[model samples]
Target: MEPAMACHADRTAPVFQTKGLTKTYRQGDVEVHALRGVDISLYPGELVVMLGASGSGKSTLLNILGGLDVPTTGEVRYQDIDLAGASDRELTRYRRDYVGFVFQFYNLIPSLTARENVIAVTEIARDPMAPEEALDMVGLASRLDHFPAQLSGGEQQRVAIARAISKRPRVLLCDEPTGALDSATGILVLAALERANRETGTTTVIITHNASIANMADRVITLSDGVISGEHRNSERQDPNTLSW
Candidate 1:
């Protein structure tokens, strides 16, 4: 294999980083390039928003960043460990220990209460917050006894967020976290993410197409055609409650 990409190689150890990351897949006789030479450095305790359209490689980058998938060519590093070059067992351990992911769908069990969902993850986590503590963080203390079916879209997503972060992960990756909810509901979910990032100092990256969501981030990264098109550093993060549709 060729040496790892050098785009961000010389930078200081970041919370998470990618150097010349690239991914391609074979579709019959044709090759589809999902990501093309992406480079980024995510700092600890920063909230980053990734803006991109469909087929723009946002999900591909997030997947690789989360250790859910490896790049075809590139170097992904978390602290001192090289993710791109890690073995399957190493990656599994990395994901289990360092990364927390929240997807678009809540994916909660129908029969499990909000607290139960959070506890499931805490049970396996090395050092985890109490399930009730996590629920409180998301402002769900009053709804902890409610099942998925008993909660609204926003509430269910908050449960998902609590479950992901109960382990106190070093990094949190969210992909279109608010895609399924209305604007009002979506802001609530975004608030949960912001609180987690601020309180725990977990480096958080959220992928979304909604420009309105960008204001809540410490930095905004724009991707197009599998390449980074723009990078913006917000002077100040916006309060989710202050955000409007």
Candidate 2:
């Protein structure tokens, strides 16, 4: 990894910093506040899990941090770049080069094989891993030729993860990665995420409603009513296999 590609290897230096961040959406005559005066810092290579109910600002905060949306007020800084003020082109470039997003849906092409799906992303990335290497990292080496229709829900999601990390993004943002799977399958998905983090040292933030998933995080952040409610750090992270919903 180049110096810029390294995901916050410097634990003391922040990869993402947000100050007094607020987001509001106008729905006809009403305004819905998504994030209100939120201040937080994410270190390099840290696995941070965000826990909150619906409308709690967890996904809103993640979207802002990932360059998918701009804040209404305050500041969002990814390193020294000011995201809140970045132009649409700048934000698009930022997302393409530095961010990897995984949603609840795998979004894999049904016609493409697993390897082909991963290759579609690696081809556009700078200093990316090969499609095979990426799948191997996510423990899908044996399933490379399998199409989305042939794989289980967890396996398909793993392919999504492989596609995301093949670019070697500095930050990995996952929203409800396991929301569509059962407990047994969810653990497998979480395990793939944990393994990717360990191998690539990508700064990972996962948004989840499951409290048990907190055990795998280096830090746990909570939000309520569009504001930060609490934050905590674990002395040591737990194995994903040991976690349950």
- lDDT tens per residue, model 2, 184-232: 9999999999889988989999998888898888889988988989999
TM-scores, each model vs. reference: 0.93, 0.95
**Residue 83 lDDT in candidate 2:** 100
For model 1, residues 128-171, the per-residue Cα lDDT tens digits are: 99999999999999999999999999999999999999999988
Alpha-carbon RMSD, each predicted model: 7.2, 4.9
What's the alpha carbon RMSD for model 2? 4.9
- Itemize residue pairs with steric clashes in candidate 2: 8-44
lDDT of 2 at 243: 78
**TM-score, structure 2 vs. true:** 0.95
Show model 2 residue runs off by greater than 4 Å.
1-10
| Candidate 1 vs. true structure, TM-score | 0.93
